[model samples]
Target: MIMFEDLFQSTTSVSLLVVLVLLVLQFFYSSFSSKQQREPPGPKPFPLLGNLFQLDLKRLDICLLNLSKTHGSVFTIYLGPKKVVVLAGYKTVKQALVSHAEEFGERDITPLFHDINKGNGILFTNGDRWKEMRRFALSTLRDFGMGKSLTEERIIEECHHLIKSFEQNEGKAFNNSQTLTYAASNIISGIMFGRRFEYTDPVFQAMVERDRELIHLMGSASAQIYNMLPWLGPFIKNWKTMMKNIKENNEELKCIIADLKESLNPEMCRCFIDAFLMHKLKLEESEIKDSQYHEENLVNSVMNLFAAGTDTTANTLQWSLLYMAKYPHVQDQVQEELIRVIGSRQVRVEDRKYLPYTDAAIHEAQRFANIVPVISSHRMSQDVIFQGYFIKKGTSVFVLLSSVLYDESEWESPHTFNPSHFLDKEGRFIRRDAFLPFSAGRRVCLGESLARMELFLFFTSLLQRFRFTAPPGVTEDELDLTPVPGLIFSPPPHELCAVSRH
Candidate 1:
C-alpha cells in the first residue's frame, strides 16, 4: 500500500512539472507574436474590400493627408487586398527616406510597373541591375553636359525657340501646354539622340502627346482599380489605352536606337545611346558574361529618361505661369526683381544668386504646385522596427510628398502660395529642408540638377520678356487653381495672355 502511494505521488509530480514548462513557453510565444503583429495603427479594414470605400482616389494625396491626421504619421490602408503603409509629415518622411534609406529603398514593382517595363528599367527595377543602370545613366548624362555650361548653352538656344513660340501668341490668350512640352522634350531628346526635333515634327508631337496621355491615364480611377485588381486589366479601358501607348512608344524608341546603331563609331560617343553602345562593345570584347548593358535596358532607360525629363519640368513651368497670371502682385515683384537684376540681358545661370526674390518665387511655385504628390511607392527591403512600429519585409510604403510639402510645422503658411516661405527676414533666399519635390535618398530624381537649371533659365528668361495675365474674357478669380488629377498635378487646361514685357 505504501509503495502504491509513492508511485502515485511520483506521477503527480511529473504531471505538475510538465504543466509548468508549458506555461513558460506559452508566455514567451504570446509576447513574441504580439510584437510581430504590432503593425501601424489604421482604420479597420473590411473582409475583402479593405479601405476602398473610405478613400477619394481622385485626390489621393489630400485623402491620405486627411487620414494621417486621424491615424498619426505612420499608418496603414488597404486597397483591395494590398496593404500600403504611408509615411507623412516632413519629420516622418525625411527620417524614413533619408535616415533609414536602405531599409525602405527597394522599388515596389506594382502590377502596372511590372507590365510597363517587365523589371528592366532603372526606374522600376531593383537589385544589381538598377544600381548598374542608374550609375551608367548618371555618368553618361554628365558626359553629355547635363548640368554643365554645355547644357546651359543648349537650354539657352532652346529658350530662343521657346521665346519665338511665345511671340507667335502675340499677347493673346493661348494654350501653351503642347509648345512647352515640346521644348522640354527637345532638351532630353538632344541628349538621348544627339539632336532636337522641331516643335512641328509629327513624330515629336505624337511622342510627347502619347507620353502625356499615358501619365494621365496611369492616374485614372480605372487605372487605380486595375492596379488593385490586375485580372480586370483586359476589361479596364485605361489599361488598354496605356498598353497601346507603351507599345507604340517602345517601337518608336527601338527604331531610333536601330538608326543610331547603323552609324556606329566606337571612338566617337555622340550621345547617351552612343556611350551605351560603345560600353556594350567593350564588355563583349572583354567577354564579360551577362552584362546589364543590353538593348532592353537601353530602350527602357531612354524611355524613362525621356518621359520623366519632359513632363515634370514642363508641368512645373506651366504652373508657374498660371500662378503669375492668378496673382499679379507676385508677378510684378518677380518682374521687378528680373528688371532690377538682369536688365534684359540673356538671364544666365550665374544670375540665380543675384535674384533672390525671383528664386524664392520659383521655389514657392514648385512647393505649392506639388507636382509629384506621392512618390512612386517604395518597398521595404527587410523587416524593420520604425517609429516603434514593426514593418515586415516586402510591405509597400507610400512616402506622401504632399504631406511634407504642405506640413504646417515646416511651412509658416502651408496652404498659401507664399514666396516668403522660402525667404528669410532679410529677403534672401533661404533653403528649406522640407523642400523635397525631387524626393530624397536612393530613388531621388536623377535629372534634378538638369531640371533645376532648366527651371531657373527658362523661368527668368520668359518672365523677363513676357507678362502673363488672365485671358481677356476671364477674370483672375475665374482662373481655377484646382489641379487636374494625374500622376503629376498639372495646371488645368486654361489659356493665358503672354503680354510682351519687351
Candidate 2:
C-alpha cells in the first residue's frame, strides 16, 4: 500500500514539473512572438492551453466559423504553442490558397504527426523535393489514366463488385463502411501495387482498419492537445496505441515495398512502386547520392497515396449515399437522369455531361459533406504583409475549407444540402469559385482528379442500380446528417437498405 502511494505521488510530482516547464516555454514563446511584426487579430489564448480549451476539438469547424465572426476572415489562433493564421470564408480562403499560392503552399509538420511522417512523402514534404515528387506522382497517375478510360474501367469494375456486396445484403439494413473502404482501397491498390485485394482478404481488412484508426486518432482532441503539450503525451488517452497503429501501418507499407523490390523491372513498371524504383535505379546509375527516391520516401509516398485515395473518396461517397437516402427526391432525380441518358447501359464518365442534375447533386454532396473542414496546416515560406497584418516567414496557416464551402456570401442556402448551389437558372452545372473541396494551388489535394472520377462513377452506378433508403423502421426525418468526428467528416454509424432499383 505504501509503495503504491509513493508511486502515485511521484507521478503527480513529475506531471507538475512538466506543466511548469511547458508554462515557462510558452511564456518565452509568447514574449518572442510579441516582439515580431504585427500579427493578425485573434482571441487571446491562455498561458499554455492557448485557444484549445475554447475550441471544440471534434467539431472544430463550428468553433472556427464562430470565431471568424468575431476575429474577421483572416485571424490568428494558437493551437498549443503553435501560432496559426486561419483564412476563413470564400474571399479569404481563396486569397490565401490561390492568389498567394506560392507563399502559402508549404505544409507544416505538426508534433502529433511529425514523429509518424518524419518530414517525408509528397503530402508532408515541401520545397524542391515536394515539387519533384509531386510532379512524378501526378505524371505516373496520369499515365495510368487517372481521369481517362483506364481509370474509368477500374471504377466500373469495382462498382460491379461493390453492387454485388450490397445485393448479398438482400435489401436489409447493413453498415457499408468496411465494404465501401475495401472497394475504395482496391482502386488505389490497383494503381499502387498493380492488383486489388479480395474484399475478404485479411491483410486488406487490417489495412482499412489501420488507416481509419490512424486518421481518427490523429484528428482526435487528445492528439491535438498532445501536439501543443507534448510533455503530457503519456497521460493522453490511447497515445501508445495510436503510435503502435502508426508503426504497424508503416511496417505494412514496408512489406509491400519489400515484395515489390523482388521482381521490379524498370522497363516494364507494373505500378507506382515499380515506377519509383526505376527512378531510384536511374538515380543510382547517375551517382545521385541521397536522392529522395530512397526507401523511406518510397514507403511514405505509397502510404500517402493509399490513405488519401481511399479515405477522401470513400467518405465522400458514404456521405453522398446517406444524402441520397435522406432526400429520396434527389436520388430519384439521379436515377431518372441515368435511366434516361443511358438506358440499360453502364453509366460512363461521358454521361456526366448529359446528367446535369446528377452532376450538381454530386458536387453539392462534396461541398456539403466537407470531409476536411480545417485542412492540413500550411506554412508561409517567406514573410509577407497582407490585409494589414504582418505574418512572419514559417508562420503556420490554416485554411477553413468549411467556411468556403458554406460561405453565406456565396451559397444561397449555405447551411443546407441543396443541389441548386451547383446549378444555375438554366439548370446547367455551374462551377462556383467558392467550391474548393480539393482546395486550390500547389498544395491542392494530390488525388483530386482520381477522387472526382471515383465519386461520380461510384455514385452514378450505385444509384442507377439500387434505391437507397433508411433501414427497416427508420424514417428520413430520423436520419442524422451530422458527421462522426475525426480527420474526415464521416457520416454517423447507421445502416441503409440498398433496395434494388433494377
Candidate 3:
C-alpha cells in the first residue's frame, strides 16, 4: 500500500513538472509575439499567419487600398516572417521614392528574382555594375536610334503591318492582343537582332509564349512562398521546375545572341547587339575594365529590352481599344482628330504634333489603364532617415505608382477615363507632373521614348482606319478596367469589333 502511494505521488510530480515547462514556453512565446505584433498599427494579425488571412490574392489592389485606409499610408505587414512596409497614397510614396531618392536607390531582388536574374542583369544588379550597365544601355540605345529617325522608321513599318492585321480581322469581334503583341515584339526584335519576325513565325510565337508563362509565374503563390522560404525550394521540386523553365528561356536567348555574333559584319554595325559587340571589342582593345561588357550582360540586356518593352506596350494598346469600344463618343473625337491631322493616309510620328487631342486621348488611356501598378523594388544603400523613420541600410522599398497616377489631388477625375486630364483650356496636349506612367528617377524605363512613339502612332493609325465597338448585348460599363493581379497589372481578357472607318 505504501509503494502504491509513492508511485502515485511520483506520477503526479512528473505531470506537474510537464505543465510547468509548458507554461514557461507559453510565456516566452507571448514575449516574442509582443515584439513581432508591434508592427506599425495594422489590422489584427493571426498568431502564426500574420495578415495573410485577410488578403485576397485575386483582388490584391482593392484589398491593399482598403488596408491603407484603415492603417494609414505607411504600414507594416508580414509575409511569413518578413516585415514588409507598404507605402500607399501619393504623398507618402513620393517622399520615399523621389524626395528621398538616393536613400531608396537599390532594388530588393527577392529569392525568385535572384534566381532568375542571377544577380548579373542590370535590373537586379547594384552599385558599380548597375551604373556601368545603365550608362552602356543609355549610350547604346541612343546610338541605335532612340528618339532618332532610324527608330521612328522601324516603328512606322511595324505600324503598317499591325494595320494590315487589323484589316484582315474583317470588322469582326477579335482579341487584338495577339496583333499588338506581334507588333510590339517585332519592335524589340528589330532593336535586338536587327531583324523582325513575321506574325505567323513559329519561333517568335514560342518566345512570346515563354515570356508570358514566366510573367504569369511571377504572381503565383508558389513564387511568394519560394521568396520567403528559399531553402524549401529543392525539397518542393516545383520551384526547381520553374527555375529550369526560366533557364531554358535564358539559354534560348543566348543561342540567338550567339547566332547574331557569328553572322555580324564588324564593319557595318546595324543593331543593338552589333553595337554592343563593337563596344566590347573597343573595351578589349583598350584593355579597360571589362566586367561590364560581358556576353551574358549583353544577352540579358537584350532580354530585358524585349521583356520590358513588348508586353507593356501591347497591353496598353489592348486597353485603349477596349476603352474606345466602351465610349464611342471618345472614339469619334479621337478619329476626328486623327482625320483632321493625317486624312486617312499613313500616319507618322511627326504627325503627333498636329493631333493634340488624339495625343491627349492616348496619354489618358495610359493613365486610365495604369499598367505598372507598383514601382519596382528599391533598397537603401545606407541607413537613412526618411520622414522621421530611421530606414535601415539594405531595407527594400517600393513606390506605389498607382497611388500617384490615380491621386485624387493630382487628377480631377482620378477614377474616370477622361482625356481632359492631358488637355489644356485650348484643347492642346499638356504634360502633367503626376503623369508618370514610365516612372521616374535614375532607374526610369529605358524604352520610354520608344513606348510613347508606339502608343501614339499605333493608336492614331487604328483610330484613322477603324472604329472599335463592343458586340451585341455588351454594354460600355461591362468592359473590365480591373487589372489582372500580377507584378505587372494587365487588363483582363475582353473582345471588341473593329468596324472599318475607312
Candidate 4:
C-alpha cells in the first residue's frame, strides 16, 4: 500500500513539473512576441532588397530626415538585409546619445570598416579595447596640452604657414583645398610624430592626398554597396581604389611607427607614438599579456586620429571661407570685429571672447556646413526599450546629425547661413545647444579641443591678414555653395582669392 502511494505521488509530481515547464516556455514566448511587436515601425521592407528602393544612398542623411517626418523621430530603415534605426532631430539624437548613452554607445562597425579595422582602433571599436585606447589617448592628449597654451602656439604657428601658402596665390584663383588639408594634417602630425612636414614635401603631399581620397571614396556609392554586399568588392571600382589607398596609407604609417620606435626613450617621450611605445614597454616588463598597447591598436588609432583630425576641420575651414566669400556682408562684420578687437596683432585664442561677431561667424560656418551629416553609426550595446520602442541588442543606429543641425525646431533660421543664430540680440556670442558639429557622447570627436583652438587661431589670423573673396570673374552669387557629398560635406571645387588686407 505504501509503495503504491509513493508511486502515485511521484507520478503526480512529474506531471506538475511538466505542466510548470510548459507554462514557463509559453510565458517567455509571449514576452518575446510582445517585444517584437513593439519594435520600431518602418516602411515595409521587401525581401532581399530590404528598403533599398526607397532610399537615396548618396544623400542618405537627407532621406532619413525626410523619412522621420512620417516614421517619427526614431524609425527603422533597412539597407539591403541590414536594419538601421535612425535617430533624427536635436531632441531625439541628444536623448539617444546622451540620455541612454550606454545603451546606444557602441560603434557599429560596418562590414567595410570591420574588414579594414579588424575590430581594432578607437573609431570603430568597442568594449575594453576601445575603452582602454580611448582613455589612454585622451590622457595623452591632455598631457600634451590639447586645449592648453602648448596647442595654441602650435596652431598659431601653422596659421603662418597656411597664410604663406595662400599668399603664394598672389590674389589669383587657386584651389585652397590642398593647402588647408596640409595645414590641418601638420597639426595632427605634430601631435603624433612631434614634427610637421613642409607643405611642399612630396611624401607628405602624397600622404595627405591619399587620406583625402580615402575620405571621398569611403562615402562613394560603391563603398555603400560594398558595405551592404561585400562579396561585390572586386567588381566595384571605388572599392578597389579605396583598398589600394588603405594599403598604401597603412604601409606609410607602419614606416613612420618603425622610425619612431627606434628613437623612443622612456625618460623623455616626444609625441603620441613615443608615449605608446613606452607604455607597451612597461606592460611587457611587468609580464602583462594581451595588452591593448599592441602595434595594431597604435597604428589604427593613429590612422583614426590622422584621418578624422585632418578631414573635418579642413572641410569646415574651407566652408567658412566659402561662406565668407558668398556673404561679403557677413565677412565684413567678422573682419570688422577682428580689426576693432585685435587690430594688426596676432589673433590669439584669448581674442575669441572679445571678437564675438567673428566667433559667431565661425560657429555659424560649422553649423551651416554640417560637415559630417551623419556620424559613424552607433550600435546598441544591449536590448533597450527606448521611447516606447524595443531596440534589440547589436542593432545599428544612425544619429542624423544633419537633421539635428538643420532641425526647424532647433534653429531660428534652419535653412539660411545666419551668424546671428549663434549670437544674442546684445551681439554677444551665445552657445546654441544645437551646435554639435563634433557630435556628442562617448564617441564625440577626440580632437575637439584641438580643432576648436585651430579654427579660432587659423580663421581669425587669416581674416586678420587677408580678405577672402570670389575669383576674378565669379560673383558671390556664382560661387557655388553646393557641398561635394562624401564622408564629409566639403564645399564644391571653387577658387577664392585671398586678397591681402595689409
Candidate 5:
C-alpha cells in the first residue's frame, strides 16, 4: 500500500510540473501576441511558409495592390521568410520614398539581388559606397553629354541607324526586337566604349539575349518559387542555367572592361571607361581601402548602365511601337505633329518645345506602357515608426508603383491610352506631377535625363521617317496593349510594317 502511494505521488508531481510549464508558455505566447498586435496588420501567416502561399507568384504587384484595399496603405506580407512592408498609392509611396527618403534609403539585397549583385555596383550597394559611386557616375555621365547637345547628337545618330534598319525590312513586317534592342544599346555603348557595334554583331546580340533571359528568369514564377522553396533547388535544375549565363556574361563584360583599360587615356577622356580609368589611377595613391572607384565597381557600374540604359529605353521604345500599331489614329496624329514641327531638321532636342503634341504623345506612351511595374524594394537603415506602425531596421519595403502609375484618382484615363493626360484644353503639352515613370526622390532613375532624351529622339525620329502600321491581315484591335511582364513589362512580340514616309 505504501509503494502504491509513492507511485501515485510521483505521477501526480510529474503531471503538475507539466501543467505549470504549459501555464508559463501560455503567458509568454500571450505577451508575444500582444506585441505583434502593435505591428502593422497583415493576413495571418502560416508556419514556415508565412504568407508565401497567399501571394500570386506571377502578378505580385496586383496581389499587393488588392491586399492594400483590405489592409490599408501600410501592411506587412511575408515574401517567403522575409517580412516585406508594402506601401501603396502615390501619397504613401511618395511620402516614404521622397519625404522620408533618408529613412528609406537602403536597398533590399534579396536572395535574387544578392546572387546577381554579390555586393557590387551602384544599383545594390548602400551607405558610403552607394553615395560615392552615384556621385561619380552622375558627374561622369553629365560630362559625357547626358542631357546635353553631345548626348543628343549620339542618340540622333543611333536613330538614323535604327531607321535604316527598319527601311531594310522593305515595308514588310518583322519583329523590332533585334533592331530596337541593338539601337538602344548603341546609345549607351557610345558612352561606355566610345563606339557602337554593327546591327549584325553576333557577340553583342548574344549578350543582349542573355541579359533578357536573366531579367525574365528573375521575374519568372520559378524564381519566386525558388525564393520560397530554396531547399528544392536540386529538383529544379533549370535555374542553374540562369546562374551560369550570368557568370559567363560577367566574365565577358570584365574582358571588355580590361580591353578598354589597355587603350584608356586619362588626359583625353574619350568615353565613360576612360574617365573611370583616370579616376581609378588617381585613386591608386589614396589609402582609402574601401574606395568605390575600383575595377569591380567600374565593371558593375557599366553593367548597371547597360541593363538600365539599354533594356529600359529599348523596351519602352518597343512599347511605343506596339501602342502606335494598336492605335493607328494616335500614331497618325503623332506623325502629323512631327511633320508640322520638325519638318526635317534632324529632329533636334531643341525642337521638343515646338513639338508639344509629339512630346505629349511620348509622355503618354511612357505612362501607358508603364514598364517599371514595381520599384526596387528599399530597406530601413534604422528602426522607424512610420504612420503609427513600427518597422524594424533592415526590413524590406516594396513601393508599389503600379498603385500610383495606374491610380484612378491621379490620371484622368489611367487604364486607357490617352495622350491628353499630359495635354490641356489647348492640346499643349503639360507635365503631371503623378507621371512618375522614372520615379522620384533621391533614388530617381540614374538614366532619367538620358532616357528622356533617347525616348524623345528615338520615338520622334522613327515616326518622322516611318509610318508604322499593322501588317496585312492583322487589325488594330488585334494588336494588344497588354504588356508581357519582365523585369520591365515588355509589349507582346509582334511586327509592324515601317512604310517609308517619303
Candidate 6:
C-alpha cells in the first residue's frame, strides 16, 4: 500500500504530462492548418488535386478570365503544388509590370524554356547576365542596321520579293501565310547569316516546320503539363514525342551554327554569327567572361529572333490582309493615301508620316487581332507587398496586355475594328499610351523597330501594287478572327486573292 501523499503526487504528474502532449499536438495542427489556408482567397482545393477540377485546362485564357470575374484582378490558382497569381485588367497588370518592374522582372524559366534556352539566352537569363546579353544584343542589332538605312534597304528588297510571289499566284486565291512566313524569315535570316534561303529550299522548309511545331507546343496542354511536372514530362508519351521534335529542331540549329563556324573568315566577317564569332575571339583574347557569348546562346538567340520576328510579323500582316479584304472602304482609303503619298513607285518607310489614315488602319488591325493576348510569364525577384497582399519571391505573374488594349475605359469602341482610335480630330496619326503591340518595360520585343519597319513597308508596298479581296464565294463574314493556340497567336487558316493594281 502507498501513502496518500505519494498517490496524490503521482496523479498530478500524470495529468500534467497528458495536458502538455495535448497542447503540443494542437499547436502543430493549427500551424499546418494555417499553411493550408495561406493561399489567397480562391476556390476550395481538394486534397492533392487542388483546384485542377475547377480549371478548363484546354481553354486557358477563357478559364483565367472566368476566374478573374470571381476572384478580382489578382488571384491565386494552383497547378498542383505551384501557386500562380494572375494579374488581370489594365491597372493591375501595368502596376505590377511597369511601376514595380524590377521587383517582378524575372522570367519563369519553365522546363521547356530551360531545355531550349539553357538560362544563358537573353530571354531566359536574369540579373547581371540578362543585362549583359540585352546590352550586347542591342549593340549588335544597332551595328547590324536594326534602325538604319541598311535595314530599310533589306525590307524594301524583301517587299519586292513578296510582291513577286503574290503576283505568281496570278489572282488565284492562295494562303498568304506561307509566303509571308518566307519573307519574314528571310529578313531575320539575312540579318543572322547574311544570306536568304529560297522558300522552296528543303533545309529552310524543315526549319520553318520545326519552329512552327515548337511554337504550337507552347501554351498547349502538353506544355502546361511539362511545366507542372518536369520530372515526369520526359516519361509521358505525348510529351516525349513533342520533346523529340524540339530536340531535333535544336540539333538542326546546332548543325547550322557548325556550318557557320566552318565558313567563318576572320578577314571578311559577315552577318550576326560572324560578328558574334569575332566578338568571341576578342573576348577570348581579353580573357573576359564569355558566358553570354557561348555558341549555344548564339544559336538560341538567332532561333529566338527567327521565331519571334517571323511568326509575329507574318501573322499581323495576314490579319491586316484579312481586315483589308473585309473592309474594302478602309482598304480604298489606304490605297488612296498610298497613291497620294508614294504613287506607283515603291513605297518608302518615310511615307508612313504622310499616310496617317493608312497608319491608323494598321494600328486598328493590330488592336482588333490582339495577338499575344498575355505578356510572357514573369516571376517575382523578391517578396513584394502589392495592394496589401504579400507576393512571395518566385510567384508567377502575367501582364494581361489584351485586357488593357481592349479595356472599355481606355478604348472608345474596344470590341469594334476602328482606325479612328489612332486618328485625331485633325486626321493626324496619334499614338496611344494603351497601344503596346510590342509589349513594354525591360522585356519589350527586341525587334520592335525591325518589325515596325517591315509592317509599314510591306503593307504600304502591297497596297500600292495590289488590292486584296476575298476569294470568289467567301463572304466578308466568313473570315475568321479566331486564333490558334501558340506562344505567338495566329489566325486560323484563311486565304485571299491579291489582284494586281499595277
The most accurate candidate by lDDT is 1
Candidate 2 segments exceeding 4 Å error: 1-37
State each model's CA lDDT, in order: 0.89, 0.85, 0.76, 0.86, 0.81, 0.79
Order the numbered candidates by lDDT, best leading.
1, 4, 2, 5, 6, 3
Sort all candidates by TM-score, best to worst: 2, 1, 4, 5, 6, 3
**Candidate 6: stretches off by over 4 Å:** 1-41, 235-238
Give the lowest summed-lDDT range of ten residues in model 4.
Answer: 1-10
How many backbone clashes does every candidate have? 0, 0, 1, 0, 0, 0
- Model 5 TM-score is 0.91
* Cα displacement (Å) at residue 290, model 3: 4.9
TM-score of each: 0.93, 0.94, 0.89, 0.92, 0.91, 0.89
lDDT-better candidate, 4 vs 6: 4
Candidate 2, residues 384-481, lDDT tens digits: the string is 78787888888888888999998899999998889988888998999888989999987988788899899999998888889999987899999998
User: Where is model 2 poorest over a 10-residue stretch in terms of lDDT?
Assistant: 1-10
Give model 1's TM-score versus the native structure.
Answer: 0.93
Off by over 4 Å in 4: 1-35
Instruction: Tell me which residue pairs clash in candidate 2.
Output: none
In model 2, what lDDT does residue 280 have?
91
* Candidate 1 local lDDT, residue 4: 31
Top candidate on TM-score is: 2
Per residue, candidate 3 scores C-alpha lDDT tens digits across 1-502 of: 0123443467666875675566456545643664643434556655445567887754556677777788887765655544556677777876666776777767787888788777675777788877887788778778778887888888889888988888887988888888898899898789888899999998888888677667666766666766765655765455666677777778888888888789888889888888888888888999887458888788777777788888889988989898888878898888877777679687887877888888888998898888877653666777765554555576556566787788888899999889999989999889988888887766778789988988887788788878898876788888777778666777788888888875
lDDT of 1 by residue, 417-502 (tens): 99999888999999999999999988889999999999999998899999999989899999998999999889989999999976
Q: What is the C-alpha RMSD of each candidate to the true structure, in Å?
A: 12.1, 2.7, 8.2, 11.5, 8.7, 10.7
